[model samples]
Target: MFGIHDLALFVVSGLLLNLMPGPDSLLIMTRSATQGWRAGSAATLGIASGTFVHILGAALGLSAVLAASATAFTVVKLVGAAYILYMAIGLLRSKAQDGVQAPLALAPLPYRKIYAQGFLTNVLNPKVALFFLAFVPQFIDANAPHKALAFIILGCIFNINGTLWCHALALFTGAASRRVKLHPAASLWLKRTTGGLFIWLGVKLALAKQN
Candidate 1:
């Protein structure tokens, strides 16, 4: 009725796509582990907001510019890579307690900051903008007069499902961290592990070429 097609398939595909490990997944899981589920939720909301921007941008045709321009893509990619590496460095050097001489560690990161980080991390990645341009339109009806609305509806559905999955991941990771924290220096190791992953993702993003 809304010029949406094969919505069941889209829903399944979106869930599967959300399952793929990336910065988004890593942030929420690590935040939940170190902070709490609330922090993860903030990150989820921020990421969702960023996805909305991509959806709107795609519907408004701004994403086409990214698709057509290599320089634009490269600029966004490098900025995103640098941000990821920045976060990686923080995680790498952070400690589990708030000490006078220690790095920002497992102590609670402000929800606003986490939210902003989530937004930046998701929005700065040019690949995500490209994905919206490439993926969301397939479900939009070609003959529909309100293609943008249809695109938005589908994007919201996709984001909603993604949020649910992220919340689950946060809860599970938080719970697991409690158990893991029983071991010696588990928190530090987890932070370092997450930092290593961010570094790998950062380098990968830096090396990404426009296709």
Candidate 2:
């Protein structure tokens, strides 16, 4: 069990980390801007689901393998980067549609695919796995019975906090859907911009060194 002081510190640190802009936030915003509220929310859920995997990996000490091995890190990083780059290319290649339809209705919304993208984006990123390995153990009681369980509990708390923050972000970014719908050109530009961001993120990930 965590002491009040440790719990408070964990909450504060988690909030700070969640608020700091990162690849996950970028992804959520991209989906919100390009797709709509539903898609954004789906992405959030997908991200949350992925976080659970990292949490479990951390609890089981599996993430340490990724953290310690340069080859493992590089392989995961490149795969994640490749996936995101593929998404970017698909977005760039998409034909512009002319319509005043609701932004969510711009195309057939594939909720499952969006969710899969979110899940894969997080799970494939060795950085995220490494982060959980590093971040969650600090507050764990060294002498606690069931250290793994303690880690899992703390990770669950972090995931819950992060999920809520992401949901709020999705709603805020999704608000732009109305404007996107009002201008067809806006949709094209938004997709292009999102695609560009993904490309940059992909390159950055690919070139990242294990820390």
Candidate 3:
């Protein structure tokens, strides 16, 4: 259903977005570094699950509604921004206790909670929904047969590419975190940087226009 140009564009776009240090990537790194590979991988799975919801929305035309309705877009954006700010506050508070020499291990959070957190983090971001709405359409050939199927195929490709890339990042960061487990100062700085990134992205997302 996809042409060579379409596949190339999807891969290039996905890679660029994956490389961008957004809230999702920052969250994955923070969780991995703090909790280890298991937690990081779990969070990565959660993020992937969330992307599926976006894909579903795109498929069902809900994303088009979100693109059209300012009120709906604003509501989702506010929720996402608030959530990121909350995460930032938690990280900042942890920084205050940086003197403690606690080993970095994944706290025993419920699996469902971890999964839901990851899912909601991405699902609630209006920008992501709108992006897919605008982005996927560009690759679709209006004159082609089975256009809907074409979009769905491309969406799955994007999701798979994104999941693999992010998972690799989580694994690598988790390994690095193991080596630096004893360095509380370094961990503290990493957490602070992560928290800052989330807050900054949240603010930028909140301020984004509907265009």
Candidate 4:
């Protein structure tokens, strides 16, 4: 119904796509490992909200503009890259504390800040908008009267499934992290390692081609 075809196939494919390792998953994992489940949940909610933006953009045909215009895509990509780089720098600069009331390797961000970070990280990436444009349309019947509605439906399905996976990821990562104690230096290194990865991701996004 609702101008959708191959509903089962869509669900399976969407789940598989959600399982792929990407920046979203990385952010959730990082929060879960370092901060705990609540932090991860905050990140997950932020990401889910951002994905809704993509869904709305796709349904509104805004994503098509990005596909059709090289300039628009480039501008967005550069902005996204810069933001990612800024986050990486923050992580890389985090200092470990010793002999304090509650000494920790990397200071955790407040839930609000973490939530905003997750939202910005997801919203700034034009790739996700493009992804929705490419992926969601396939399940929509071309002859459908309400193609946009169908697209939104598919996007929601994908987002819901992805959110479920993210929560599980956060839960497990947090639980496992609690079981392992890290040296101050090691935790600092962990933060930097993640930071380094974000840099690579930012660079790759900056260099992404419109084609």
Give the Å shift of residue 102 in candidate 4.
Answer: 24
Candidate lDDT scores, in order, read 0.70, 0.67, 0.64, 0.72
Model 1: per-residue Cα lDDT over 96-168, one tens digit each: 5521121123667799999998999898999788767655655544445566677788898999999899888
The most accurate candidate by TM-score is 4
Rank by TM-score, highest first: 4, 1, 2, 3
Q: Write the per-residue lDDT of candidate 2 for residues 1-211, one digit (tens) a residue.
A: 5411257756865775566555676677777877776788898899889999988977777344443554554454466567767867965665567313343333435989888888988888987877665555445433344556776888898889999998887887788654433245655655666667667656755675544
lDDT tens digits, residues 16-71, model 3?
A: 55554556766676677777667767877888888878877775673445535546
Model 4 regions lying over 4 Å from their true place: 62-106, 178-211
Q: Alpha-carbon error at 30 in model 1, in Å?
A: 0.9
Query: Which regions of candidate 2 are displaced past 4 Å?
Result: 2-5, 62-109, 178-211
| Candidate 2 residue pairs in backbone clash | none
lDDT of 4 by residue, 148-201 (tens): 677788999999999999999788778877443334575566566766766776
Best by lDDT: 4
Q: In angstroms, give how far residue 99 of model 4 lies from its true place.
A: 36
Indicate whether candidate 1 or candidate 4 has the larger TM-score: 4
* lDDT agreement of model 1 with the native: 0.70
Error of 1 at 169 (Å): 0.9
Worst 10 residues of 1 by lDDT: 96-105
Question: Would you estimate the TM-scores of all the predictions?
Answer: 0.63, 0.61, 0.61, 0.64
Ranking by lDDT: 4, 1, 2, 3
